[model samples]
Target: MTAKAHADAILNLLRTAPGTPLTVLDGSVPNGTVAPYVLVYFADEDPELPDSRPLDGQSQRYVVRAYVHSVAGNGAMARAVGDRVRSALLDAVPTVAGRVCWPIRREEGRPPERDESTGTVVMDRVDVYRLESVPA
Candidate 1:
């Protein structure tokens, strides 16, 4: 599947999740928008090959950023939002458009930090998955 499809799948998962505060979107949130919210963006895609043979599948990577604003700017709320995002997506093998995206993994994550310009706390998480499109 394409990066946009991967992002959309993750966004849909988060949107339907119970008690999740993330406002998952296909793109970045509007300027001056307040938190708590999340934006799902396509990062990159690489070919997955076990041998030197022609490519059979793809490894897609997506970045999910959770944001929250606080007067203290302590990032506590932002971290909480990040935790929710992680809970919803980490280790999930969600399906998109009837295709299975398996072996989804949390590649990396960043701790919440204060954005000087927006004065909001933000946390970034990266998720990678192997989408097997062809026989092995």
Candidate 2:
């Protein structure tokens, strides 16, 4: 599947998952978006290795970010949201249109950090995942 399809699948999965925070279909959070929200977006595609073949399946990377506003400046709430996202996505298979996708694998993770650019006390955790797929 294409990268956009992979991202859409991830977004849909998170949006429908029980106990998951409100998920943003696009990566950008609206100006007044509430905290404890999730952002899902397509990051990058894996480059084929030297030994890879033309018929080899495609691998795409997607990023999920969990954000929470906390007055205490602690990232506990953000971490909790991140945990929910991981529980719902790690090693989970997402349905991609016109493709058969393998179980998703986490490529990297960033612990919760404070973001000050928005002029509010916000914490965010980032998780990156890779999805492999072949045309159905």
Candidate 3:
């Protein structure tokens, strides 16, 4: 997908960070991998409404899942790839961290949903596109 491609490119760029001693790999994140994702919930964390508590009294942080698998060795290529991918993902989608209520999507599973009464997050969708696959 175009979004994945773009994401991949962005991730690859992060490999250039100074003093990094690992190889940057592109198009290497596993495609058939999947796993559980949970929300790091917070309370009354809305920046605009710091004094207001969510109707449910809980705020959601990081409503996305991270599924990274690789066939490469544990050190160089694999580690670098992981580092860059993690950094890139966080940078490109800052809300993916333990502080934002990103939406969740799935191909064969139930996604998160917002509670109507509480206005708490019910569902979150995190969209990422890998832009390149050229291994470093």
Candidate 4:
């Protein structure tokens, strides 16, 4: 299984998970996308065991961000979405072709912050996860 394949599996899981927010995007956010959505993308990846001759598989890192438009400048909605995302993905094993993915583990998380780039009070909470996989 390749790193990109692992990422795609994770995105698919999030998109279908019942606990996740309604809007789940794979890397790119369409213009005029409503608030209260999730953006998922690959971050970093490395071989699971560099010394292994057969190349076991990959350890991939992915970033999942929950965004919400908060006119109050508060992150309550964003945080809620983040919580749902965490619950939906943490320790969950996703099905990937030619790969056996282990339970997803959270590497780190960041508190929600307001995005000032667009002059809109958009609150986003970021979290990183690690997924290790081996050939099936």
Highest-scoring model, lDDT:
4
Q: TM-score of every model? A: 0.66, 0.76, 0.26, 0.76
Which residue pairs show collisions in model 2?
A: none
lDDT of 2 by residue, 1-136 (tens): 3767777777776777776345554657677776777766565545565554355455432333222221124488777777777777778888877777778777778877788887878887777766777556
Better of 2 and 3 by lDDT: 2
* Segments of candidate 2 deviating more than 4 angstroms: 50-52, 55-73
The deviation in Å at residue 44 for candidate 2 is: 3.3
TM-score of 3: 0.26
Arranged by TM-score with the best first, the candidates are 2, 4, 1, 3
Off by over 4 Å in 4: 19-21, 48-73
Model 4 lDDT per residue over 63-85, tens place: 23222221224599888777777
Residue pairs with colliding backbones in model 1 are none
Global local distance difference test of model 4: 0.66
Go through the candidates in order and give the clash count of each.
0, 0, 20, 0
lDDT of each: 0.53, 0.64, 0.31, 0.66
Error of 3 at 87 (Å): 3.0
Error of 4 at 37 (Å): 0.7
- After TM-score superposition, the amount by which residue 135's alpha carbon in candidate 3 deviates from its true location, in angstroms, is 37
lDDT of 3 at 27: 35
